[model samples]
Target: MRTSRFAVTVTAVLALSALLSPFGTGSAQAAASTVSPTGTNNWSCKANAAHPNPVVMVHGTYGDMTVWNTMGPALVNAGYCVYALNYGSQATASMVTSAGELKTFVDKVLASTGATKVSIVGHSQGGTMPRYYLKNLGGAAKVNDMISISAANHGTTNTGVTAKMVGYPTCVACSQLMSGSSFLASLNATDETPGTVSYTNIVTSYDKVVTPYTSGYLSGPSTTNIKLQDDCPADTASHTQMPSDPAVIRLVGNALATNGPAQATYKAKCTW
Candidate 1:
């Protein structure tokens, strides 16, 4: 029964990836020149002294800073300083490299915010890319917490099919890029979840990508994985809706406000 369920999940993930393949092409670009305000006025008005770290948002594959269009402002309004950057572009001259470019951006955020460390919130590849920064680039000390939304921590197997179809090496290369390579292995070898940072993996059972949603989990003492359905029960949010899901937004609000793992109380109404 477990095997059958896993297979169904994998099939659903691949199908969702195919469905989103169209709008999912682009490097992180500034979504807009002007910053608009979200009416919540919950997180932007003042920075809670307890959680002094600013929040930095990272977008996943084919996504840019714009992915947080709605949530960023909400954070800002809730009294938290918010910033977003685009990394891991494919082009050579693009100024950033996937997984490799995170340190530079982290440095920029630290320097600009005047905060020694910051919390990271990432979506899809955005969530997975930071392992490199944490392990290789000395980011562990600088990052206070990491919140991953629909991130692919372990490499995806759907790439297996693509590998067979488009030459094994090409697919293998892509998987490594999406997750990590020997670099991640070395990091995991020392500490699967480094004690220095708090790791929270926010995933939905209905996620249509990141095959084997269990891949979103991090193995460490400080790491906690929350399945959205378990939290909201009624919320069957898919991958695309994760970033903007109101329940997710509220969960994030509660998480940031409390600075610890808190139960999600918001229930989804089957509106998706």
Candidate 2:
């Protein structure tokens, strides 16, 4: 079932999200200002009343917040107070450890901005691990929205092999991403997307990390599943390229327009 596709400009997307935001103060200053990538925040920046929910960018396994360099500034330029953190950076770090890190960082964002909640933008393991925090570590109440790019949600296979046989003793996170892993099983045991937290999964058919791409799909109320090539058949964005892929960026922007940009899905055409 195909629906109408509208290519709303990024500015319009942010504007719409702001309007539907629970924190917009209708101030001209916050709605239009931009944050430099090197700007000193120290969490001192106040949440834009128009878009009060600060956005926290989480990185994937063996990756850090620097990965968001391409996407973070874009959000800041769009008038959002952006933040990013590195979790599960260690090979031995359990998913619970990363989830705890997320909780702590989220609390800091809330307190720093004096805001009650935040929106999460995670990539790869960045996307997969947060759900554990939300599902088991009491994170649903703090997150307003979650946008996962290439998440290992339902678990994936290791080069067509199951986790049970993939050198599990070395990389804990790797084992967890495989299908049938106890970590993944318990993570999906309850409602995948709980509360009013809107969930969006931006996956790529060219994904090699999250094999069988379908494993990344998240289902729940207000949850949307977007295949980078579904609408743009020409798109060849790989799992590693999603953060910088123009098409993926736009899709994420539309998803962030949670309040009232009825035109969230856009027409995309990318080649090579």
- Number of the top-ranking candidate, with TM-score as the measure: 2
Q: Determine which window of 10 residues in candidate 2 has minimal summed lDDT.
A: 19-28
Residue 9 lDDT (model 1): 29
Candidate 1 overall lDDT versus native = 0.59
Q: Give the winner by lDDT.
A: 2
**Candidate 2 at residue 26, lDDT?**
18
- lDDT tens string, model 2, 1-272? 01112222232333222211110111211121233233223477787667778888876654555556556655665667788765554322578888898899899989999888888888877788989888878888888888898888987775332222222334467667778889988888768787777888889998877777888897776788888888778778777677756577666666665662213356543421
Off by over 4 Å in 2: 1-42, 90-92, 159-169, 260-264, 268-272
Predicted structure 2, TM vs. truth: 0.79
lDDT of each: 0.59, 0.67
